[model samples]
Structure formats: structure tokens, C-alpha cells
Target: MEPWEMREWYADYLDACNRHDFDAIRSFVAPGVRRAHLPGGADAWVSDMADLFHAFPDWRWRRIQLVVEDDRLAAHLRGSGTHLGVFRGVAPTRRHANVAQFAMYRVTNGRIAEFSGSADEVELLAQLTGTDR
Candidate 1:
């Protein structure tokens, strides 16, 4: 896909995420795609996302910027959500946290073939726990 087309596709994916449409999300990822922290590949990745929904039912992400080259995409996103369930061993604080995330993905035939990257978990923890770090 051209860079513009990739961006459009990625924007639609983000729309799916913001909508918490897991079924739609599945279509964007190739079956058995690997992720370091999660096993079961694409299913696990989607499950992890479900876990996040449980923790923060209103979680939403907004794109800060995106860069695409060939089949690779780099995304910078800002997210915000209200904690409603346990996550990362932290009990619900009923707090809202805003965080930045950076993710890199490789798309093949329009499905994500590889996914990697992270969000500001430390900062999120600090905000939720009400502690200086």
C-alpha cells in the first residue's frame, strides 16, 4: 500500500480500537502473529486488549503522528482511560490516566504480520497510585 493508503488503513484500525471492537480488531492481525509478552499470538494479543478493556472500560487512543514505509508502520499515540478493574497488579483506583504509547508494526497483505512496542506504564502506574517515582 502507498504511505497514504497505509495511513488510512491504520486510522481505521485505531478507530476500531477506540470503539473497543475486538472482532474488527481480529481482522487487522494475521492469525498466529507473535508478541513478546503474550502467547497464543493474535488471539492472545486481542485477549490482552480485552484485559485492558476490563481494567479501563473507557480507554481511548488518539494518534499523535504516524510514519509508514513499505509495509512497516510506526505510530505515536496518546491514550486516556478511567481505571475500573485491576491491571498490572494494581487494584482499581477509579482514576483516569493519560499516557503516551509508541508502537511499530509490519503489515503484510494488509494484516499486521508483526507487532511490538510499549506505552508509558510507569507513568500510568504513578498516576493511578498517586505516588512520585
Candidate 2:
């Protein structure tokens, strides 16, 4: 796919994520898609996303920047959500949080084949835990 096409595809994928549309999200991923920081296949990634959606029903990803090179794409995003359900053993705080995240994706045959990302976990934890930090 061309660079612009990849960007469009990624934007659509992010929209699916915000909508919590699992079927739409799956359509963009390969059956064997690998997650670098997680152990398991595409199903596992979907499950993880489901859990996240459950915890933060209004979760959204806003693109801050995007860069495409060949079949790889890098995205910097601002993720925000309300704590409406249990997450990581923590009860709902009913507070909202905005965190920065950087994700790397590799596309193969027009489908996402690999994904890895890092978020501001410490800040997220602090917000969830109601800590001053």
C-alpha cells in the first residue's frame, strides 16, 4: 500500500478502536498478528482491547502525529478515558485521564502483522490509584 493509504488505514483502525468495534478492528489485522509486549495471538490482543473497553467505556485515541515508512507506521497519540469499571484490580475512580502513547505497527499484505506500543503507565496508575504523583 502507498504511504497515504497506510495512514488512512491506520486512521480507520483507530476510529474502530474508539468505537470499540471489535469486528471492524479485526478486519484490519492479520490472523497471525503479533503483539511485541504481549504474549498471544490476535485473539489475545482483541481480548485485551475488550477488557480496556469494559473499564473505560468512553476510551478514545486522538492522533497527535503519524509517520509512515514503507510498511511500518509510527503513531503518537493522546488517549483519554473515564474510569467507569474495574481495571488492573482497581475499582472505578470515576475520574478521567489523558495519557500519551507511542505505537509502532507493521503492515503486511495490507493487514497489520505486528504491533508494539508504550504508554504513560505510571501516570495512568497514579490517576487510577488516586495518588498525588
Query: Which candidate number maximizes lDDT?
Result: 1
The global Cα lDDT (0 to 1) of model 1 is 0.91
Can you write out model 2's per-residue Cα lDDT over 5-75, one digit (the tens) per residue?
Answer: 99899989999999999999888888889888686577887888898889899999999999999999999
Lowest-scoring 10 consecutive residues by lDDT in candidate 1? 32-41
Off by over 4 Å in 2: none
Q: After superposition, how far is residue 112 of candidate 2 from its true place, in Å?
A: 1.3
Computed on alpha carbons, the lDDT of every model, listed in order, comes to 0.91, 0.89
Question: How close to the true structure is residue 98 of candidate 1, measured as C-alpha lDDT?
Answer: 94
| Pairs with steric clashes in candidate 1 | none
TM-score of each: 0.93, 0.94
Error of 1 at 50 (Å): 0.5
- TM-score, prediction 2: 0.94
